[model samples]
Target: MLRTLWKHVAADLTLAAPLLRLHFHDCFVRGCDASVLLDSTANNTAEKDSPPDLTLGGFNVIDEIKTELEKACPGVVSCADIVALAARDSVSFQYKRLLWKVLLGRRDGTISRASEVIANLPPPYFNFTQLKQSFSSKGLTVHDLVVLSGAHTIGNSHCPSFDNRLYNFTGKGDQDPSLSPPYAAYLKTQCKSLSDDTTQLEMDPGSSLSFDNHYYKLLLQHEGLFESDAALLTHKTSLNEVKKMLISRNFFAEFGQSMRRMGNVQVLTGTEGEIRKKCSVVN
Candidate 1:
C-alpha cells in the first residue's frame, strides 16, 4: 500500500524526516492524536502555526492518504495511524528496506493551540543538558535522545536554525568553538543572509537524503548543524551511545527500538479521542 502511495507523492526524495518530525511534535504535546494536522480557526491558532512547528512538512501527503483511506474503509483508519505508517514508509523509501512496523488504532484529538508548540518542541540551539531534559519530559531516555538524533541523517533545515553558529556564536561575533572551522566557513557561504528563511541547510552533509549512520560520523568531526546535535558528545551516556552506533552495524535495530518507544508517548487508544473525517479539522 505504501509503495503504491509513494509513486504519487511530489517530493519523493524528501519527506521521511518531516513525517517523523510531525509524529514527534504530535506525541510530545498531547500524545500522538493527529493534533499537529489541525488547522487554525478564527477563535484559536493551531499547533502547525507555532514557530517550532512552522517548518513541518508532509501534511498534504498525510491528508491525501487519509482521504483515500476514508473512501476505501470509512472510519476504520485513524489520522494518527496514517502518520505513523507514513513515517515508517518514508524511511523505507530511502533505506530501500523496512525499518519498523507501526501499530494502528490511534485516535485523533480535536485540540490544536499554537501557544503549546514551543514549550513542547525544543529549539535546535539547545545544548546537551537541555536536550536531555526536553526528551526526559516526554519519557524518552538519554539513549533514545542520541538514537533518534540519527534522524538528522536525512532532511534540510531553515537557515535561521543554525545561523548563529555561522555568523555569531558568542556575543563577541565569533563562530561557535565547538563547530568545525572549515565547516563553519562553508555554512557562512551557504547562509550569507542570516534572515533568509527560504534558504535551506542540509543536516547531514554528504548523505542528507540517506538513512544511515553518517549523522553520528559527522558529529564526531563537530560538523553537526545544530547545538543539540553537538550536545550528544558533552555527556558520558549520550557520547557512548553515539560511539556505539558509529561502530556497530546494528544501529538500524537500535533506531527501530528507540522510535517505537518514542511513538508510544502519551498515546490515546480504546475509548479515548475521536476519528476525524479530515486530517485538517475536527469533526
Candidate 2:
C-alpha cells in the first residue's frame, strides 16, 4: 500500500505546476536527489562543489502539501519520498500519461554542495564525449544518457545557460553547426534581451508542460536548444540510437524504461541521509 500512498501523494503535489517544473529541472541536471533545490550556507561556500541558490519557488508549495499529508497520514510518509513521488507524478500528470515505476523508501540527503553542482551537472555546450563521460561517472550508460535528456521536455534554461550556443557557431570552439537554422533563430530571439528574465528558454516549444516524446521529435527536427542536446544527432555512438528512438514507438518505450533505471541510481536510503527542513538552504 506504500506504492499506492506514494502515487496519491504524487498526484496531489502535481497540482502545482511550478514545483513540478522545478523538480524536472533539478533531476535532469543532477539526478533526482533534490540537491539542486538546496540553498547555500556560509560554511558550504568553501566546499569543492556548492549548489546555486536557484530560489525554488515551488518549495513552499511542496511544504504546504507535505504538511497536509502528514496530518492526514501521520509519520507514515517521508518528505524525501514525497519529493521523489511528486517529481515522477508531475511529469506524468503534465504529459497526461504514466510510464514508469518510482521506488520508495529513499531518505533525504543531508549534504549539498555548490562545487559538486558545477562539476557534476553537464554544461549546455558539452559535446557527446563529455556527456557520456559525465553520466558514466555516475554509473549510467549511453541509453540512460539519451533517456534522461528527455527531461528537457518540461524545463526552461536561462540565457546564461545557453547563450554560447547562439552567436557562436564554430564547430571547433563554441559554435555547433548541428543546431538547425530555425532552432538557432529561436534561441537568438529568446536571448536577445540582456535581462535575466530573457534567459527563459523553453525546452519543448510544442508542449512545454508535457513529458511525452516531444523532446525526441525536437532533436529530430534539429530544434534542440542546447549544444549537448544537438550533439546527440551528430555523435557516432549516440546519433543512430537517437534517430531510431525518434522514429520508432518501441524505441521510445525502451527510452522510458532507461529513465526509470537512471532515476533509481545510487540513492541514499534508510538512515543514510537526512530530510532538510528547507530545500534551498541546507541545514
Poorest stretch of ten by lDDT in candidate 1: 3-12
Q: Write the per-residue lDDT of candidate 2 for residues 149-233, one digit (tens) a residue.
A: 7767765666766666665556433545677877777677668733444457677885765555678888888888888888787
For all the candidates, what are their Cα RMSDs to the real structure?
Answer: 1.5, 4.7
Tens digits of lDDT, candidate 1, 244-267: 989646678888888888778878
Score candidate 2 by lDDT: 0.62
- Local accuracy by lDDT, each model: 0.85, 0.62
Give the Cα error of residue 69 in candidate 1, in Å. Answer: 0.7
Q: Look at candidate 2 and tell me the lDDT of residue 280.
A: 50
- Top-scoring candidate (lDDT): 1
